[model samples]
Target: MTLPAVLRSAAYPYRANSLNLFRLILAAAVLFAHSWYIAGRGTGPSLQGENLGGWAVAGFFVLSGFLITRSRLRSTPGDYLLHRVARIYPAFVVVLVVTAAVFAPIALLVETGSLQGYLTTPVTPLQYMWGNLPLEIQHYNIGATLQSVPYPGAWNGSLWTLFYEFLCYLVVWVLGFLAVVRRSPVVVGALFLVSVAVYAALGVAQRGGLDESFALFARLLPFFLGGSAVFYLVERWGTNLIFGVASLAAAVGLIAAIPHWGGQVAAPCLAYGLLSLSAVIPQPGWIAKNDISYGFYIYAWPVQQLTVLFGGAQWGMIVYLAITVVVTAAFAWLSWVLVERPVMLAIRERRAKGSTRSEQLPGDIQPAAGT
Candidate 1:
């Protein structure tokens, strides 16, 4: 059968596309946005009261939701959970270790002239790495290592979102196991609606009291759900340029009209529009082959802090950003090459070995991917 103008399955296949390039851009955008703060200026500029980094993160959630949902629907429960853990935890664990052992010590040596008293500090390097091993950022600084930096105490400010992102993953997992996503996506769509309602109720909830984590979850949940909605819609209707444009127009209007929360409400359209765009845009072979966006994001803040320790804060925003791009990109490349890709490839190979051709689905759809 001839496909629609463009097949959603084709645009959002498990691998190979401009999505990687888009993710790279988003990751760098975070680095660029954070340069101001790392250099002691402040949040440089923002849209609708959210910083550029914040918007980039929201964009990440939208894409992740779509991609991760696809992952769940296509894999076994055990395999899906393992892939999620392997994808997120190993690199995260590596970054934490690097921040604590390498960067923090360097920060101490630069500040106090020795790593002599380091182990006796309040939260020692081991403690710092161990405390946050679970993805929840329980420790933001290794003792007093980052206290002198411009942002002060937060070594990896970008890390807090990982906890929320994992939670979103688990949420999708639970929904997938119940057949809610594949069988009754309208319920998934409704969850997005409820999250949006919570978004509208946030101001009132803050005055009346509400958990910060839940509030943050409410903020990101719609985007994730919207992504899931987009996946289903695209699968059902395929992609059309006109619909993509119209969806983007609607998303833009919501984003402009609503203040801080409009983007969450606009997520499905935004995700669809962007995914549709991805169908048309061709990605570079280099970026399409290797995904370092996750590494770039996780490593950026600490690298920036190190840059500050060496007096990068005085170099001005442009210089700081330039240096950061080079250093962080290198780290990201190493992460994909050394840790993330190898670990994932190993796990994928193991799973493939365990499965047989008879068990495969007729039109087995592949996940787009987040990390």
Candidate 2:
């Protein structure tokens, strides 16, 4: 089966193309934010503004929750796990290996003054490779020494978000399973709220109230619940203009408040509301039809880091930015073609075979009669 056929048969109601495009645009926003930080532009006045990239990460969490929940609603637990693993881990492993074996060495060589110094340093090539191994399982900052030595001091700084994303996936899977067994949204919501509170408290105690851990958990849990709520609302009330307008308003209010309200509280709220609105609104654009946002999100950081390593910090920020864009676009294209497409095809084939086998089975098959 082709991609189009799989999409057409998908049980979810929203348009994939539109969501994908939104994700890509958010990813670009993230890249720009990171670039600004790297260039020493600070969070002062600029065309793109400061720290908008953090908002983009917020958007990603909400989007992930919305889409992943949508898929879970239509799949068995086994199938859902299969799809999620295929979507995430393969690219993750590939990037981890490349960053460890290829990028880390090149980055070290570029930044260090002497080969002897590089070798003699405690954080040697072997140490760097070992550190990247923890990254495969989401333990970052293990062997990092300096924040800027190799650009993020680790293979990929952006990967920190993936750990949270995977955690969100596990949360959704468990909640979804419980919901299916008990058929109670209230129970699921309660459980989610408690988890968020505990996560928030732990984050605050561990890193003080200033750290991202509390903020991230606080922000993301609501967004995930918001997506689940959207699904519930749509199912119960049906998609209509009134609810659509409310969701749109909520989204707009959230976005407009992001810069002022601060990322700690405002960003996740905005992302959740916007994604909720997006689920209801009709996608109507060429860009929406061919969205590649997730692809852009996961690939842009490493590409930028690599550029910084090779091109030198003295190189113009604009030049580095342009190079990052070009390289990231190429990577995004490849990810869509090689990683996402094949996995999706395999999913479709498996589903089709399962359906066929079930159809072939008879209710009254008399195995004892041996006909």
> What lDDT does the true structure give each of the candidates?
0.78, 0.54
Query: Model 1 reaches what TM-score against the true structure?
Result: 0.91
As for candidate 2, its clashing pairs are: 24-293
Q: Count the backbone clashes (under 3 Å) in each candidate.
A: 0, 1
lDDT of 2 at 335: 68
In candidate 1, stretches whose alpha carbon ends up further than 4 angstroms from where it belongs are 1-14, 207-209, 356-371
Off by over 4 Å in 2: 1-17, 44-50, 112-152, 179-184, 192-219, 238-291, 312-319, 355-371
Estimate candidate 1's alpha-carbon lDDT, on a 0 to 1 scale: 0.78
Give the CA lDDT, 0 to 100, for residue 103 in model 2.
61
* lDDT (tens digit, per residue) of candidate 1 on 1-371: 77564432443443434777778788888888888877888788888887888778877888888778777787888777887788888888899888887888889888888788687787878888888988788888777677777788788888888888889889988998685568767888999998899888898888787888778878888888898878787766666666778888998899889987799999999888877777667888887778878888988988888898898768677788888899999999999999988987797578778972222221111212222
Among these predictions, the greatest lDDT belongs to 1
